[model samples]
Target: MNKFLLTFKDSKIEKDYQENKLNTLQKPIFYWLLVMSFTLNLLKVILDYTYYTVNNQSWMNVGFVILVILELFLACYKKQYIKYALIISNLSAGLLQINFDESNTFPQEYYSYGSYYAMLSVVVYFMTDFPYSVFQVFIHLSMKIFFTTIKSHRIDMLGIILGLITNVFLVLTLYICDWNSRRQFLLNLREVRWEESLPFIIKKPFYLFTYKDKNMSFQVNRAYNQDFFPYYNQEDCCGCNFRQFLRKCKVENNNLEIYLFDKRNEKLDFDLVYQNKTHKFDIRVCAIGLDQINYLIILEKLKLLTTSYIPKQTNLRQKIFQIKKTQIKYQHQKHFLLGVFSMFLYNNKEITSINLVDVLQKFSSRYFIISKSKIHIVYSDRSIYQLITYKHQLIIYLIQLFDCLINNQADPHSGIKLLLNQGLYAIRLKIYLTNRLKFQEQYKDNFFIQEIERNILSEEIDERLEISFLKKVRSAETSI
Candidate 1:
C-alpha cells in the first residue's frame, strides 16, 4: 500500500513546473499581487459586515489582521518561503470562513461571501506553476464541502455542482494562461541567447543575407543594431522598415547590378548619399561577398568618419617611428578578423575596459615600474575601429586586472562614441579576444595552462598570466 502511494505521488504531471514559472515572474509582479489581495480582502470584510454575526465578528477580524501581518513578514523577511507559506495561510483562512458558516440556520452561500477568498487565492498563485495552483484550489474546495456537509448532516447537490463549476472553471482558465506565458518566456530566453552568440560567429557587427534571384531579398538579416540607419522620418514614417528601405533603395539608386553581380568574390567600398528630397545624409558602405548571392554589408555615417578625433602630431615621421617602437615593445597585439569567427571554434580573450581608480589602488601596493608607456587596445565593429592609447604609467602586475571588466562587444560604435563625447583623453582601447579556443582546445589537457587562462581572464585576473606575459620583458631588462 505504501509503495503504491509513493508511486502515485511520483506520477504527478508537471512536477516542479512552478519553480521555472516563478523564475519568469518579476519580484514587482509578486509584490503587486500580494498588495492587491490583502487590500481587496480587507475592504470586502469591512463592507460586508452583515455576513458576520456578533459572535463571529472578533474571530474574522483577528484572523484577517494576523494574515495581513504574516503576508507583510513574508514579503520582507521570508520571501523565499512565500510559495508554501501563502498557500497554507490562505487555505486556513478559507476553511475558517466555511466552519463559521456551518453554525448559521439561514441559507449559507459560502461560495459567494465566505469562500470567495479561494477564488482570489487561485488568481494570486496563478503566477506559480499550473499543477501546484490547481492542487491548492482542490484542497480548499474539498475542505469547504467536507466541513459543511459533515456539520449540517446534509449535502446540497446543486450547491456542490455550482461550487465545482465556478472553482474548476477558474483553475482551468488560469492553467491555460500560465502555460501560454511560460511558453513565450522560454522563446524570449532562447532569442536573447542567440543574439549574444551571433557576434562570436561573425566577429563584426555586419549583416549577412542570401539572394537566390534578381529580387535580392535577405535569408538571414542579423545586425547588432536594427536601427543602424534610419530610412524614414520618426514623425511621418509609420510603416517604414529595413526591408522596405532596401527595396526602395534598389529602385532609387538603380544599383541592383552593383549590389549583386559586380561585388561577387570581392570587397567594394563606396559612399552613398541618400536623399529623399526633404532630408539627405551620407553613408559609407563596405560590401564583401563569397559568391554572387551571399554578401556582408557594413554601413557607417560619413559625418562620424570625417569629424572623428585625430591626434595632432608635431612630426609625422617621428610619431610613426614612436608608434612602431611602442607596438614592437609593448603592444605585440594579435588582430582577429570577424571573417574567422565560428560558433564552435572561435573565442575572444581580449580585455577592454578597466576602472582608473581600481587600477591605481592595486598598482600602489605592487612592485613595478611607474614609467610612461603607450598601451593600445583596439575595438571595432566593421567600418571604424576605436583605438584607445593610455600614456600613463602602469605597473606590470596590474596587466590582467582589467580582464574583469572586459565584456564582449555588442554595439558597433556606442562605447567609443560615449568616451569621445565625454572628452576623455588619456584612456581609449577596445579589445576583443578571438582565441578562447587556446584556453579550451590548446590547453584542455594541460591543467597548468588552463589554470593560467582562467586566472588571467576570469572575474579577477590571475597574477600568473600577467607575470607570464611580462616574463620576457623582465628577462630582457635583467640581461641588459
Candidate 2:
C-alpha cells in the first residue's frame, strides 16, 4: 500500500479508537424529514380514527388521539428525543390502524401499507447521521417484514422483492453520495492549506501604508498583480513555513517589509503597513524591469528552473533576458498606443485624436492671449511638448516625454501634439516648480502655487504616473 494511504488509515484508527463522545445530532435535513414523517403519521391517525368511529370503536379513537398529542408534545419540548418518539409513535399507530385481531381481520392487501411505512423509515434513517437511529431503521424494517409475512399467511413475494430492492438501492445511493461528499471536502481542505502556505514562498518585499480622511466619502484602494506575485506551488513552498517568514519580515514602527527572490535572480520588495485603520501593502521595487507581457516570460523561465527534472544552468540570466527582449518586442507591436488608433478605426469607431488636438490648440491660444506669452502646443499621441515663451524669448521648453516610444499611424503628428500639450498644461498650472516665470508674478498673490508645491513632488509624480497606467490597463480589460 501507498504511504499516503497509511497516513489516512492511521487517522481513521485514531478517530475510531478515541473514547471521547461528542454530541452527534442529526443535521437540518434529518429534522425536516422527521417533521414530514410526523405530518404523514398524523394524517394516518385521522383516517384510522374516522374508520374506528364509524365501526363503533370509540375507545380506540380516544387512545389514538392521546398518543398523538403526547408525541406532538415530546417533538416540541424534548427535541433531542424526538427521533425515538417518532419511531414509537409510528409503530404504535401502524399497529392500531391494522387492528390485527385473530377473530376478525382485514384483507391481506391492506397490510402492504406497512411496506410504505418501512420505506419511509429507511429514508429518515439515511438522512440522519445519528448511529442509534440508523440501527433502529434496520430493526424497524425487520419487524415490519416479519409481521407483514405472518399477516399475509403466505409470504408476499412482490412485497419482499420490492422491500429488498429498495433497501439495496437506497443504501448504495446514500453510501456513494456520502463518499463523494467526503472526498470533495478533503480536497477543498488540502487547497485551503496550500493557500495558507503561499506567503512563505513568495517572500514579500515591502509594506505600503495608506490613509484616508475620515470625513471623506471615498476610501483608498490598493491592489497587487498576480503576475509578479505568482501562485506558490505546495511541494517547494511547503518547506518554507509562513510563520517563520512573517517573523523574519522585521517589523519596524508597526510596518513590515520583506524581499523575495525568483529563480531568474529577480528581486521584489513588498511593504506591509497599517493604513486607513487597516493593513495596506505595496510592491516597492521589482528587479524585473519589463511590463506585464515580459513579466510572464520570466515567470515561465523560472518554472523550468525551479522544476526538479530540469538540469540547472549558470547561463539562466542570459536566457531570461533574451526572453524578456522578445516579449517587449511583441508588446511594442501589439499593444502600443498607436495600435489603439488602428483598433478604433477597424472597429468602425470615431477617432478621438482630432478632438484631443483641437482641445490642446484652443487651450494654447487662450493661455497665450491671457498671459501675453507665446504658448506653443507641440505634441504627439505619446509625447507632450510645450514652448513657454514670454515676449518671443523661450522661457522653458517643457517636454513631457513618454517612457515607451511606438509607431502610431493616425495623426502622424499625434506623438508631437501629446508631448506639446502635456508640457503646456504643466507650465500653465506650474505643477512642480515654485518659482516658474509664468506663474511667478500672477500666482505670487495666490496660495495655489504653495499648495501645488506641497502636492506635486517628484515622488508624487512617479506614483501618479504608475497609478494612471494601472487604471488604464484595468479599465481597458473591463471594456474588452
Candidate 3:
C-alpha cells in the first residue's frame, strides 16, 4: 500500500510538471501567432492597395478588400484568434497568383510586388508548426520569380539573383532562430522533468557518512551513491573538516550508536555493505532505517539550490486575508455614505458604461490599505466586476451569496433573510454535503434562522444598491 501511494504521488507530480511546461509553451506560441497574423493581414491590405493603384486592376483589389472584411469579422467572432488568422492567411495566399504574360500589362513584378509576398512568407514561417510554412514559402517565391522572368521575355537575371539571395537569407535566419528556440525549450523541459523525479530519489537510502574528532571538533565525510549521482567520487580524501562540533549519533531499530575518535584521521575505518559484498573505505559509515535523515539533508540542499531559480509566491492564506480586508473596507466606506455614492455613479445608467476599472481605481485609492489585493465581482448577467480587497472573508461571503442566488432562492435586497427563511432546509442540506456531517447534528434546531439574520446584516450592499440606483435615476445614461 505504501509503495502504491508513493507511485501515485510520483505520477501526480509528473503530471503537474508536464502541465506547467505545456502552459509555459502555450502563451509564447499564442502571442507569436497572434502578432504574426496581425502583421501579415495589415501588410496584405497595404500590398493589395498598392498593387491596385500601380496596375489599375480591380479584380484582385476587390477580392482583397472582401478578404480584409471577412478577416475582421472572423477575428471578432471567433474566440481562437490565432486559428482564424491561420485560416485567413491560407485562404488569401491560395487565391493569389501572378500573371506571367507581358501582354496582360499587369504582370506581378518580382522586386516591387514579390517583396511584400516574401514578407508574408516570413510571417508564415514563424506562425506555422512545421515544414508547411517552409514548403509554402519556397513554392510561392519560386513561382513569383519564374513568372517575372517569363513576362519580361528574358532571363531577368537581376530580379532572379536578388530573389534567390533574399530567399536564402530569410530561410537561413528563420531556421537558426527556430533551432535555438526549440533547443532552449527542450532544456527547460529537461530541468522540469528532473525536478519532478527528485522526490523518488529522496525516498531511498542513497548516502553514507563518517565523522572524526580532533581538538574538540569533528570532520565529517559523506558519500552519496545513486544512479542519478554523477559527482559521487569528487570529495578529496572522502572527508570535510569542521570545528565547534561534538560526536555524531543516529538511532536504528530503537538503538542509538555514537562514534568518538581521538584524531580526525581515526574515523576512516568503516565499510559499506551492499549487494552481499562489503566495500571498505578510508572513512565510511553505514546507516539503516534512516530515511527521514536522508530526506531532511536532501531537502535542505534542494532548498538552497532552488532559492535563486524559483520565484517566491504568496501563500493562499495571505491572499484570502488581503481580499477579505479590502472587502471590509469597501463595506465600511459604502455604509458611511449610505450607498449614495454607488447610486450616484451607477444611477439609471447602462451597466456596460459603468467603467468597472475606473471604479476599482477610485476604490483602491480611497481605501489605501486594501490596494494590493485582487478583487473579482461576478454578476448573474454574465458580467464580471472586479476590485482589490485586503481579506478573503468578503470573497467567501460573496461566494456564499452567489451560490444562493444561483439556486434561485435568495432575494438580492434582503439576501440572507430570504435565504434563511426560505432556504433553511436547503442550506442545512448543503452543509451536510459540504461538511460531511449529519444535518441534524450540526444545525441542532432553528440555528438556520439565526444564521440567516446574521448573514443578511453582513452581506455586501454593492449589487442590489447598484441595480436600484440604475433603475431610479433615468438621466445618468452610459454607453454600452
Off by over 4 Å in 1: 1-53, 99-111, 114-118, 158-175, 206-480
Tens digits of per-residue lDDT, candidate 3, 23-95, equal: 4543355446555545655665576476634543345545655665665676557534544455455545633
List the candidates ranked by TM-score, beginning with the highest: 1, 2, 3
Q: What lDDT is obtained when candidate 1 is compared to the true structure?
A: 0.42
Ranking by lDDT: 1, 3, 2
The local lDDT score (0 to 100) that residue 361 gets in candidate 3 is 39
Deviation in Å, model 3, residue 412 alpha carbon: 45
Q: What RMSD, rounded to one decimal, does every model reach?
A: 20.1, 21.3, 28.0
Give candidate 2 misplaced runs (Cα > 4 Å).
1-25, 37-52, 55-119, 129-137, 157-162, 205-480
| Reference-based lDDT, residue 439, model 1 | 28
> Candidate 3, 417: how far from true, in Å?
29
Measured against the true structure, the TM-scores of the candidates, in listed sequence, are 0.39, 0.33, 0.30
The positional error of residue 268 in candidate 2, measured at the CA in angstroms, is 22
**lDDT of candidate 1 over 325-428, digit per residue (tens):** 55432221111111111111112223343443344434322312222222222223322322221111122223322221122223313221111111111222
Which residue pairs collide, candidate 1?
347-434, 347-436, 348-433, 348-434, 349-433, 350-433, 378-430, 388-428, 388-429, 455-462
Model 2 C-alpha lDDT per residue in residues 447-476, reported as the tens digit of each score: 222222211111112211210101011110
Better of 1 and 3 by lDDT: 1
**Against the unseen true structure, what C-alpha lDDT does each candidate score?**
0.42, 0.35, 0.36
